[model samples]
Target chain A: MASEAENANQAPDEESIISDFFVPLARDWPGAYGLADDCATIAVAPGHELVIKTDPIRAGVHFFSDDSPADIAWKALAVNVSDLASKAARPVAYTLAISFPEQPSRSWLGDFTAGLSEAQEHFGCGLIGGDTDHATGPMSLAITVLGEVPIGKMVRRVTPSVGDRIFVSGTLGDAALGLRIRANMVDGKKPEQMTDHESLLVDRYLRPKPYLELRSALRAYATAAMDLSDGLGKDLGRMCRASGTGAAVYEPDIPLSDAFMAVAPESLEERRSLISSGDDYEVLCTVRADNVANFVALAASGGVVVTEIGIVRTEPGVTIIDKAGEAQDWAGRGYDHFS
Target chain B: MASEAENANQAPDEESIISDFFVPLARDWPGAYGLADDCATIAVAPGHELVIKTDPIRAGVHFFSDDSPADIAWKALAVNVSDLASKAARPVAYTLAISFPEQPSRSWLGDFTAGLSEAQEHFGCGLIGGDTDHATGPMSLAITVLGEVPIGKMVRRVTPSVGDRIFVSGTLGDAALGLRIRANMVDGKKPEQMTDHESLLVDRYLRPKPYLELRSALRAYATAAMDLSDGLGKDLGRMCRASGTGAAVYEPDIPLSDAFMAVAPESLEERRSLISSGDDYEVLCTVRADNVANFVALAASGGVVVTEIGIVRTEPGVTIIDKAGEAQDWAGRGYDHFS
Candidate 1:
């Protein structure tokens, strides 16, 4: 899209920005036309369909404005890729629409595009086409990712049956804890962190590594799936509502990382609150009883940890079993932007 | 994407927003799963490829922040559709990622979704999936459109031959003039009451109707094509440079609308400047000398008025021939956001 007003003369021209920064990221994709054309083309295999997702993040809204540009770029792509991974799709290409409040220095763009290059290589996708513009607000990026999945094979969030066992990948609440740690640092409530666990937690908050390797296993055995974005409690409630069922999650079974254990509050209430704080990009899935062993084994073979944390039920809302063996309602407890 | 912070309590929740305002937009697309799934799936026809473009617009940057929400929604989708139309592709679906600085009123969202509904009907496409967030900046929308064209048949912006005749759809400067009118109104230079011509110009600025009916003619006849968002001089220069050719555009042959002529300044220089000022959203294309007659006839049959404005040249730059028949360099004169 074209901006209505000409920007300050200090910024680099659009042509140079594309040629010097974005063009290299697009070199691997022939269909990108070297970013010289208005649109990009993608060819889907005969029996495959395209899975599409668009997610955008803004500075100060999603991340601090002073955060590293490379981390910002990676998070923007990673979030969208995480959705594709949960759908059991293999990413093919992506388009990036970026808005800058002012002209960024060459070093910032260099680190940003370098981050994009690294992400594309890691995820096995390439840049196709995009739009860049000057904004009257904070810097924002919207990335639309295209992935391929066999027809009728995508793991949907609305397909879980009453007897399905719920599982989650990796650990939960690490990013949430990481975010809190950063908030304390910004508030001067803590000294410059010295703990390795604190650093690990902050890294988790900065860059989420989407588990693309588990796509095959999920597609083969999961009855329903979605990425844990809005916290497991609320997102699982959404899935259950869509599937016309409910779930029972065991608090003791909810996986927590070593870093989270080392740095988080000791109170069970606070721990539970952090668990539902969202930003966990891990895949949340449900498998039939008969396929649980196979799904677990396959995911394990791919070096992805799968922890059974819950079970689908005939009830209409999600319940979390406390360590004391009492069932407590936990539906709608995840992060809500408008709440 | 999940927002990291909770917004003020005054706004409607995200769940209600999606179900009330957006779910209807996805009703026709089964792969959208009623907007309940994490991602949407698209199936391409056997002999076709997907043509994708992502263009985003922001309040205060692309349009006035107080612009009608309906008009804002329409322009966001129309600009992207215009690009696909220039590629001779049929828009199939689109994903919209929107950020609002605060929770918008129900009435505002109602009008916005209605506008999206109207646009989808107008363009023969459906909304698939998207993300909504509360921003700390101006409201912005990033729309990614997916269109389809026969394999290897998408019009290229890099294929114009030396002898090809250049053509452009519709008029040249109505939108540019309209934008000027809007700026004057904002600046209190224009009266509150607008002439019908001025009103028409403003409408052109607000909502661009993509010339999609001419896609068949373009796919069959045009050697190269691109949408004129950055004005004829600069965009044509881009096509020429990419195709390794030059162009000579005749000033007398440039088309203008009755509304533009009635309200625009009478000076030849100012008229030429407006013609080069960007935001036309029209198609600029090239046809082989032998195909010009057929292309014109077919475009005319489709109710599209395509004017022959120039011819491709063996020289190395775009030159505008004045009414007095003197060639003047007019390259790189279009809107550059960073300029």
Candidate 2:
């Protein structure tokens, strides 16, 4: 797989990376070098406790077979740490268990480590401990990230109230559009596919950003929040379910960007399509309607994108309004693990 | 699958389990909810911290396909925690991911959860997180356990000196022999199948107790140590490799239960075979000769078996002598993960 990449004849396989990358995790880590053991030990200290989360990336399921190893590593940690951000947690440590196809090339490992290094650097997360091995076939990358949150302030999903207004950070649907581009689709993706926006969207697919910078503000302002994965429509469905309230989202109110406008244009059909497409790693949140203006203003001061998209209602179902003021039809959209 | 399981059945439909069993992980683990994001929140705690470990259990590789689900769960945690015990760490929590075939039986899942609950209760370990999904085929279980240890006290497989006495806790070969029993070869496992002494041998196989009680003392007294997952021959070879030492064993001095006499009274070959079989799950430590007698007596008082199997030597090779002073030849006898 490493040999086949079109560019970068250099792959991730290097002895230096093996030695330099993970040594300190064992040297300075609380319970490093705990071989043949259940867990490496962490000695809790004042003002810091363990933050932990796990997510699985499976071969041929989460990524294309041809995707670079670096991307795989990035997504593995990014997805897990993104959860930390929602709780306003500061990531401190992470461990990885990667099972690869037997005799995998060393460059693949090198690229994977580079991705991990990049993400860790971005988040100030240290590589604490991990394990690796060869499996019969298929690759499964499982990561557990440990972070830190201030005492008594970690966010929860069940905090949205009936009168809360729904807000979203960043643009949605780009990742799903990127998926279309990867599959060689032209018309289905937003109009921007004809231009350089294609690259931006595709990058979103390959490397969804972890919004570590937004954690503190989220803890301060948003009553409830989650990253928009599995599509805005489906994931919003999850949040509403958790908070026990219904929602009414106005399509025209959703915040769109120049990148999105250049791609989506102002078509009613195109706007409807964005609701159900998955893989946008933006934050969807709820706040009292009275705070929407201040929330947007505060987020803008921080240089983050926040748009009021909807409101929580007394009823218990997600309702979407089209640009033409008609109710939009819903379908079985979004990725379901079984379906 | 649910039909045969009984009154308390997990949803038989694969879709329901995907949504119900795995999804509830977010609800059950408040630390990981991260406000309904892709990952969970983690942080370092005051006076304590995070430790990480990952271990794999493959079908037909680690356990038989026909083993009950409950037993499989117990074995999975047992093997992983056995490593923690060797390090004298207190298990804090764990995350589990299962890559399983489609259409597993309902009885299997119920049993699997039962086993997990049983082991968790026994070890005082709570499962904080996990992922479950369908693999292409075959069953694979990977569990990552986290434990707590005091700063600077966790043990490792290093630091043994040339003169350290090599020690092993608990009996060997019984679990290996137990495998033989599971395979319908009752040659030496069952007590009634042989004599009274041999029955005790069978007990060792069914549930090989890990030396959790000895963890603290070893952390204080031992130079280097490892769990005897494989046989003494190979596991000791590993300890020597890590510590850069050789060993000399007085063959007749190796502890042998009278079970050997009952199972194979006249067969020296059978005795050797029993010794070499793996899955002992005992702790193998390299202790200074000065501490040898004291260590043995200390562990014995705790109602656990501890024996001096050999001595670390300045010579750069392993040497074994029989009762008659004749050199005894043995191959690398232990479990090899890969052929």
- Best model number under DockQ: 1
lDDT of 1 by residue, B1-339 (tens): 434233223356798889988999999999898999999999999999999999898887678777778989999999999999999999999999999888887778887998888988999999999988887678899999999999988998989999999999999899989888888788554545888999889889889999999998999899999999988999999999987899999988999999999999999778888999888999999999999999999999999999999999999789999889998766558888777
Off by over 4 Å in 1: A1-11, A187-193, A329-331, B1-10, B186-192
Cα lDDT of model 2 by residue, A234-311, tens digit: 777777776678888887787665666666647656655765676677778887877777777777776787778888
All candidates: DockQ:
0.75, 0.40
- Per-residue CA lDDT of model 2 for B129-226, tens digit only, reads 66676767457787888776656666677667998988877666666655655556333333345555444554455445577788666866788877
Candidate 2 DockQ score? Answer: 0.40
* Model 1 lDDT tens row, A57-126: 7887677777788989898899999999999999999999998888876677888898888888889999
Off by over 4 Å in 2: A1-39, A185-195, A255-277, A290-298, A329-332, B1-50, B103-105, B180-208, B249-278, B314-338
